[model samples]
Target: MRKRALDTVFALAQQDERVVYIGSDVGQGTLQGFQESIPERFFVEAISEAYVIGMAAGMAMTGFVPYVNTIATFLTRRCLDQIAVDLCIGNHPVRLVANGGGLVYAPLGPTHEAIEDIALMRCLPNMTVLVPCDAEEMERAVRASLDWSGPIYIRIARGGESVVSLPERGFFIGKAIEVRQGEKLLIATTGVMLQTALEVQDIMARAGYNLGIVHFHTVKPLDTAWLANQLGPYSHVASLEEHSVIGGLGSALAEWLCENGDHKLKRFGIPDRFADRFGNQAKLLSYFGLDAASIAKELQAWVKPS
Candidate 1:
């Protein structure tokens, strides 16, 4: 997804001279390509995310569209004042292309993990929070952010993901995309968990249980009307993500449904515990019961009445 986003920024920069790519002294691999392509427009700051955001805001003041890239934790957590005051409050057209969203850096420990980025960014006024499910969606998100008037926060995983079905054969901002149809349960997911959701859908279908999958590419400004119509009838709902349950995708959905619509819902993601051991991505996800088998089991158990 980062690679696709870099390509997207490059393409957008080429077409519109006003587009600029800013970096906060990170992401060497992807930044190399952007520098090689558009050296004049790309700028890398020295170890200061706050300054990077301030600089981007300064550029935006001159009508330049700057897409800042860095790890999610540092980009949002470390420099929120700059982000909130300089960009979001001013409604600047600065795009924040954040990577390592959720626990992607689980082996690197909790400090690097960006579990609360979504909630933090969503709380800021005039900020658009987005977490694309795959590379294609990432590309679409980049294009969508270009036309956006205010600051945009795009949370993405470290690597590529499988392509899921779109909403009725298309994509739209501030709208929920339904991936699959099921009768037994509904799983609404964001980030890389869409892969696990699809796999769970297949396994449940084989077991004669139908399910519905809603891929929510847009986290903030959630499509409550669409969710109300789609999830209104379902008796059971499971919101999944790769981040902490505190203020991520699941929490966002649960809050929306709790206030505006009436529904029974549960969240499935990394539990409210920091990982004590270092391991690969697959092992970390499995440790948190985010794997397909665990999710399927949870869903099947939910189907059984207490």
Candidate 2:
């Protein structure tokens, strides 16, 4: 997914002179073709994340659309002040290509994980938060960022995610796509959790429960109109994400339900705690009861009557 997004940025740079690529000490030979093609517009700086954001802000001030790539934890935790002051304050057209969102860096421990990135980015004013499900959707998200008016924080998982998003459904920023249609239960998801939600949908279907899954690719400027319309038809609604249960897609939906309507909502995500153990992404998800089997079991308990 990361490679696909950067490749899309490179493709866009070929056509648009305003496109610039900046990386904060990423792996060697990353986007080598882009650097060779557009030497003047490509930069691979040291581990100075704050300085890199400031540079991107300056480039944006000069009417250049800069795409900054770095670890998600560094982008959100290390450069909060620069992002808040330089990007959000002025609403710059800087695209933050954050890698290792959620527990993608689980083997590297909590220091590298970005479990709270969504909460951090979504709270900033004028910041658009996106979490594409797979490589194909990441391409669409990258393409959409080219014309976006303000700063965009796109959270992507490691490569090799399943393609749950269909081309026929189309891609639109701030629009929710309903992948499955059913009554009584609504499973709203963001990021790679859509894949788990789809699996849970099938599991519930086999067990005689109809489940609907909605992919919320854009979280900040949420598709409230579509959500509002969809919320009215379902008796139980659940939100799933790889992020913390607070201030993420689930929290956003909870807030909207609080104001606009009344519905039963169960938010499935990382609880309010740090993942101190060292393991891969699958282990962390399983530990947090976010795996497809665990999610299906929880949903069965929630949807079934006492």
Displacement of the residue 229 alpha carbon in candidate 2, Å: 1.4
lDDT (0-100) at residue 70 of candidate 2?
93
Clashes by residue pair, model 2: none
Off by over 4 Å in 1: 27-33, 165-168
Model 2, 1-306: lDDT tens per residue? 999999999999999999999999999999999999899999999999999999999999999999999999999999999999999999999999999999999889888999999999999999999999999999999998999999999987978988878878778999999988888899999999999998888888888887888999999899999977776558889999999999899999999988987789999999999998887998999999999999989989888721
Clashes of each: 3, 0
Q: State in Å the error of residue 293, model 1.
A: 0.5
lDDT of 1 by residue, 225-297 (tens): 7787776447788999987888888888878878876567889987777777678777888888889999888
lDDT value, residue 85 of candidate 2: 100
Report the number of the highest-lDDT candidate: 2
Candidate 2 — which residues are off by over 4 angstroms?
A: none
TM value for model 2: 0.98
